[model samples]
Target: MAEEETELSDEQKKEIAKWFLLNAPAGEIQYVAKDLKSVLNADDVYNEAASEAFPVYNKSHMICLGMSGHFGDVLVTSYGELNENEYLDPKTAQVAIVDHVKQVCTEVRPATDEELPSPYIEEYRCALEAEMLKYVSEAYPKGVCSVYCINGKDAEGPGSDFELVVVISAARLSPQNFCNGSWRSIWNIEFKDDIQSLELKGKLQVGAHYFEEGNVQLDTKHECRDSTIFQSPDDSAIAIASVIRHHETEYLASLEESYLNLPDTTFKDLRRKLPVTRTLFPWHNTSQFSLTREISKELGIGK
Candidate 1:
């Protein structure tokens, strides 16, 4: 039955490819065919099948499969290598980054008079409050035009470290000016040193922040921080965008050199070499439930 289903899917894919070839522009037929080939060549369907068949597959396999499938082995390989060299492999560096972020992000618990208190919850709350206060003070000394903080867990899901989101209202900050200069300058200043200076015992990962402009007018001195997490709150989007754009351009210029260094192979071979799994959705896997529960416990929440 499974074999029949697989055959049917392949047939359907072929039919779709034929339809695309006939309907698409004559000049674009090759491109469409290439895309179809890539999709059919993907290893995700096989990995998914294997995962469904074997419930005991480990987390590393799942993560590798999912990330490698979705992002491609080249991207995963590059990112993994970069992560190892830049943050993971070096114990000292990894510790420094994690510790730095934790230190800067950690907060002393505020005293409370409530009876039957939960110390864990209190500590977590204090840490969050401190992080919020610190960022607000550093970025908006006068007071935030707006503030949005959502409590969540890290990318690895519930048992992972806290994911604290702090979105400061940039209504009062001049979007144009920030889009022009301040954002870029700040990112360049903090990007490397801050992460390098940290002394902790874990990997440090950062994501970029996005900006949305509305009706509020921003002051000239402030702007929305650029998307990079490692960038300082004072960094402006305009400068960072320009810098990133330039960097990409430069990177592309060296693609030929990079490509020459890689081995020539078909997409299918690459896909098989790197299976796919859903690593980003950690909650989807039941195996990690215990870890999640532990995280909740740490946060002083009911298991």
Candidate 2:
């Protein structure tokens, strides 16, 4: 007689999904979501359901564990990166869909308060400020902004040992945005940073405060780099000009390359669209060492 195969129950399937959600390897969930999206698009059998999950998981196939839904329809209340260490904790057990055929997890939204470890939940609070500070500082490092980090003991909980406060010019990005509880509109972070108080011992806690006009303090207490050079937005333009004049040969060549094979536009129009310029011209160099007028003349713009 042939051995009988035991069919798994819905509860058993859910348990399997939870296990995979907590134990799947890094990037596996995202890859599976991508693969399922391709499958859904190619196959007409699975009814396409609109999703409000992260942009990456949109239109992907899923098997909802909590609700009755179609192939592509699943309510993802929240999601986050699976921490294997938290697998033992029952509260960390998540109710989500899984791709049993592929034996992988599909998607997990941002970590809900109940899902994360006690120590990590507090640190996650400052996620928005941290990301925005990183983005602005990197995008406009030419003195457009400054990042100040402070290291301190976590007075309230043993989980954290430091506090991070960020300051930025309201002209660049308003502070209200951070305080508004609308992080998704600002930027979508795929994986959040893990705050370890021990590793931050030699590191600096960068912070930003909103400032308006005039000169502001750039006294960043970071251990890695000096952020004092970032004084003001206007000064950044001057600094850019100085650096270009200092490296005139190489930069000018790069600038010419950027301008080549492009449609002709007026100097005013070009200056207006300088943000999208393929090359950074010395727009602030107006005194003795200046390329503003020369470049304009070269571009066939009249005085």
**Highest TM-score scorer:** 2
Local error of candidate 2 at residue 288 (angstroms)? 49
**Candidate 1 TM-score over all chains jointly:** 0.17
lDDT: worst 10-residue window of model 1: 89-98
Report, for every candidate in turn, its global Cα lDDT versus the true structure.
0.29, 0.31
RMSD of 1: 28.2
lDDT of each residue in 1-303, candidate 2, tens digit only: 997799755455444443433332222344434544464443322212212122223112111222222222222211221332111111223333444334334553433544433433333333433444455445433212112223331234433343322222212223333211000111111111233211211222222332344322222222221121322223432332333223323433544554563344644455554456466765575453346567777898846
Global CA lDDT computed for model 1: 0.29
Off by over 4 Å in 1: 1-122, 145-162, 173-303
**Model 2 — which ten-residue stretch has the worst lDDT?**
179-188
